[model samples]
Target: MNKVKLAEGVYYVGAVDWNLRDFHGYNTPGGVTYNAYLIVDEKVCLIDNVKAPFAGELIERISEIIDPAKIDYVVTNHVEPDHSGSLPVIMAKAPNAKVVLTEQGKSGIMKHYQTNYDFMIVKEGDVLALGRNKLHFLPLPMVHWPDSMATYLDGEQILFSNDAFGQHVCSSMRFDDEVDIDQVIYEAAKYYANILMPFGKLITKALGKTGQLPVRMIAPSHGVVWRKYIPQILAKYEEWSSGLTKDKVIIVYDTMWGSTDQMARRILDGVAAAGVTAKLYKMSVSTRSEIIAEILEAKAILIGSSTINNGMLPTVGGLLLYLKGLRPMNKLGAGFGAYGWGGGAQQNMEELLKAAGVAVQPGLAIKWVPDAAELDRCFQFGLEFGKSVLAANK
Candidate 1:
């Protein structure tokens, strides 16, 4: 894309990664954008950059507005490779421009890049004058990374948040009002569940620290910029960080010989019969990243696996490990499984849920293929769990 103006002096000069399929282990079927902003004033300044491969695209966009060599300052809000990978190239082109970052950001840059570049370090409440506009830096450590911070423009009332309100979506639209609101909200929630769920407390603290600012726009480093629904996104962030959940249930399981699959289906029926919304996902077919997204707001989770050699299925085990690392809060969970000679998969899943700080109930394990009576028992189990979810939510 070309340079798109946001305000009178602010322009978006970023690259869209339309072909990106996966980010780390998180699925990015919708791709993403590496957003950077250029503020043209008496002192021309650039905030953040694209990935290393897209560095030339960013420079080309900047060339449309003004010569890159004329840039007076470059500010890095976060040192993640997606945003800082092109810093070396940018600094080389704008040799006279001063690089501004927080102290931790400096360390991260140095560690990632071999070049020795002097940095103008700023901290919380520090302001850098750029003629008519002033950029205020706020240190938001551990919101995702230690070096993460946000830059607020005094005149425009825009918050250049690095990754806090970002979504993994690639589109031609630049602003929130220009796109489908439902899709944007889904992608935003998915991004938060996959990337920022583990840092809930830190996000809450950061929101508290910066809540008083007059934020008219939130220009993040990914997806579309937020101009129309600033309060809506902020309210969502507040709700998610506070561990608020909905009255829903998520059933995730991996089946063998169709026995566990039968149990899952019967349980899902019972949950619906109890007037509770429930989603069923087979772990072998469903991506763990998507499952994590579903688990984000659901009040209860049910995990199942078939025992093989006295152990849980590998897919279920891997998902448990991944979910544990993300550490989703305010969830009640239980496990169910079908075993041949020995029954240990349900016990293992229950233990993992407990270790991950989920309030877990006693798990149900059936020996061999589930008979009709066993399926009935599974249905009752689901009904009880669904009722408990309603009670807890109330």
Candidate 2:
């Protein structure tokens, strides 16, 4: 993509990854974008860079606006390879430019790249003057990464947030208003659920620190820029960071011999009967990342796994492990499973849920394939769980 001007002097010089399907384990079928910004002023500045393979594309976009050699400052918001993999190449082109990043960012860059470069370490509330424009730095440690930080362009009222308000979406449209609002919000929630869920407290702290800034535009390091819907995205981040959830239930299960699957369907039916929105996902068929996204806003999560060798199915175990790492908060959950002889899957899942900070309730463990009576019991379990979810929401 070519450089598109965001403001009078700020331009988006980034690359879109339309073919990317997976990001670290998160299923990103919609692809993603590596957003970098070029600020043209008395002292030209470049905020963030694209992935290593897209470095050439990033430079090509910048060349359309100004000679890369003219850039005086290159700001590294986060040292994650997706945003900083092309740092060496850009710095090589802009030889005279100084590298400005957080002190932690400095250590990370050196450890990752093992290269020496002119560095200007910055901290929270530090300001850098770019002639008429000023860049205010906000240190956001553990907001996904220890080295992560955001840059606020005082003149344009733009927050160059790296990964904080981003989505893993690749679109020809650059701004939030130009694309489908539902798709944007879904992708944003998915990103937050997968990458930022573990850092809820840190995110809350970051939001509080930058809450007073006059942010009219949010130029994240990925996906579309937020100009018209800044408040909408901010509100979402606030809600998510606070561990707020809706009256929704998610049922994730992995079945063997179709026994557990039968239980899952009946439970889902009961949840619906209780006037609650419930989504069912089979772990072997559905993407865990997508399930995690659903769990983000869901008040209840029900996991089912058929026992195998005195343990839960591999797919269910893997999903629970991934979910545990993401650390979803403020959720009520339970487990259910079918076993031929030994029953341990329900207890295992409940333990995992508790480890993930989810409030665990008594789970059901059925012997072998469930009969009509057992299915009825499953339905009752779902009804009780759904009602409890509704009560918690109220």
Per-residue lDDT of model 1, residues 1-394, tens digit only: 4558998899999999999989988899999899999999989999999899999999999989999999988999999999998998898889998889989999889889976686899998899999999999988988889999999998998999989899999888899999998789888999999999999999999998778799889999999999998889999999899899998999999988989999999999888888899999999889888889889999999999999877899999999988888899999999998999888897789888988789998878888888989999999999998888999988
Superposed model 1: Cα runs more than 4 Å off? none
lDDT, residue 305, candidate 1: 96
Give the per-residue Cα lDDT of candidate 1 at 208. 84
Per-model root-mean-square deviation over C-alphas = 1.0, 1.0
What is the number of residue pairs that collide in model 2? 0
Q: In order, what lDDT does every prediction score? A: 0.91, 0.92
Summarize candidate 2's per-residue lDDT along 195-288 as a digit string, tens digits.
9999998999999877989888999999999998888888999999999999999999998899999999999999998999999999989998
